[model samples]
Target: MELQKTILKDCFILKPNVFKDERGLFYETYNQNVFEKTTGLKVDFVQDNQSVSSKGTLRGLHFQNGEMAQAKLVRVVRGSVMDVVIDIRKNSETFGKSFSIVLDDVEHLQLFVPRGFAHGFITLSQQSIFSYKCDNYYDKASESGIIYNDATLGLDWHLPEEEFIISEKDLELPTFEEAVS
Candidate 1:
């Protein structure tokens, strides 16, 4: 696996070596040894979650606060998506900065987002199946989110605002400034 670091410190893009033939392809999506070597952080994943969404559907800009914050390894198993992560750690130098990548079945790339970052994605194909492993289990009480279209952040989701479909809960999320205050 080849790990490329993102601008936001510990975040990374993991590209696995794929061996293929007419039969199909094979690759190790995650290996603990490689992960520890690459990031220097040992993670114990406790939960795996999957979601399916249609094109133009936006899922996040979500995070967990306090002790419930989760570190995630995300990938697309079917179709494609434009995955995004925003650095939300209050004391970090890159706070408020965002990183994005196109994850598709063909490339088979996985994104590693550490705790203290907010994550979200937009489906780009007819239907997308997204999966992720989290270092921490879900805690509804600690769940929090920022508006996907928070103007102050000026995230270029690679889609027009009107073209995107977001949940009412997401729409009601606070802006960055509001969140900070």
Candidate 2:
């Protein structure tokens, strides 16, 4: 696998070395030794989560606070999505900046989202299966988020506002200013 940096600080895109033949295709999704050697990051994933969403569905701009913050390695298992992240680390140079990438089964690309960022995705295909590995376990009390359509973020979700299918919980998320405060 090759690790490539994104515009966002400490974030990366992993391109796997795929082997193809008449039989089919294969690739190593994750190798702890190689990952640590390649990126110099020491992460012990404690939780694995997956979600299936239909086109127009939007989730996130979410994160955990303080000690419960999580670093994530995310990928698409089937279909496609526009995965996005915003730097929220108060001391980082990229704070308040956002980055986005298309994740799909065809490319088999994975994104490494460091702690101190808000993460989310919008499904672009008929149905998509998203998977992620989190370095820390989840804590309900520590969970928080910025609203997906917060004016300050100015995110281009690539779908019309009327097309979005959002949860009531996500609709009620705080704004970027409120989140950082």
Candidate 3:
């Protein structure tokens, strides 16, 4: 496994060395030693979550506060998606900045988002099956989110506006300025 750092501190893109043959293919999706060696952080994933979304569906810009903050290992297993992560840590230099990548079954790549960021994705295929491992469990009281289309963040989702779809909860999420103030 090879871990490449993103613009945001501690965020990473992990590419597994896949071996293919006439029969099939094999790869180590997660190896603790390599993960720790590359990122220099020990994460013990406690929960696994999976979701399926149709093309144009957007799910987040979500995170938790305090002890419920989570670090996520995210990947798309069935189709493709435009995965995004935003730096929300008030104390960090990159606060309010965002990073994005296209994750698909063909690449089999995974994204590691540290605890202090907001995470989300938009499906780009007919249907996308997304899975992730989280270092912390879900805590409703600690849950928070930023609006996906917040002007200040200025994320280019690369999807047609007419096709974009978001839930009422997501649409009601606070903006970066709203959250800070």
Residues 1-181, model 1: lDDT tens digits:
7888899978999999899999999998788898788778799999999999988999989999999999999999999999999999889999989999999999999999999999999999989999999999999899888898888888778777777889999989888777756
How many residue pairs clash in all the candidates, one count each? 0, 0, 0
Clashing pairs in 2: none
> Candidate 2 lDDT, tens digit per residue, 1-90?
898999999999999898999998998878999889888999999999999999999999899999999999999999999999999999
Candidate 1 deviant stretches above 4 angstroms: none
lDDT of each: 0.91, 0.95, 0.91
Worst 10 residues of 1 by lDDT: 154-163
Report the number of the highest-lDDT candidate.
2
CA shift at 137, candidate 3, in angstroms?
A: 0.3
Residue 15, model 1: lDDT of: 92
Compared with the true structure, model 3 gives a TM-score of 0.96
Please, what are the lDDT tens digits per residue for candidate 3 over residues 84-160? Answer: 99988889988878899999999999999999999999999999999999999999999999998888888888798
- Which pairs clash (backbone N, Cα, C closer than 3 Å) in model 1? none
User: lDDT order of candidates, best first?
Assistant: 2, 3, 1
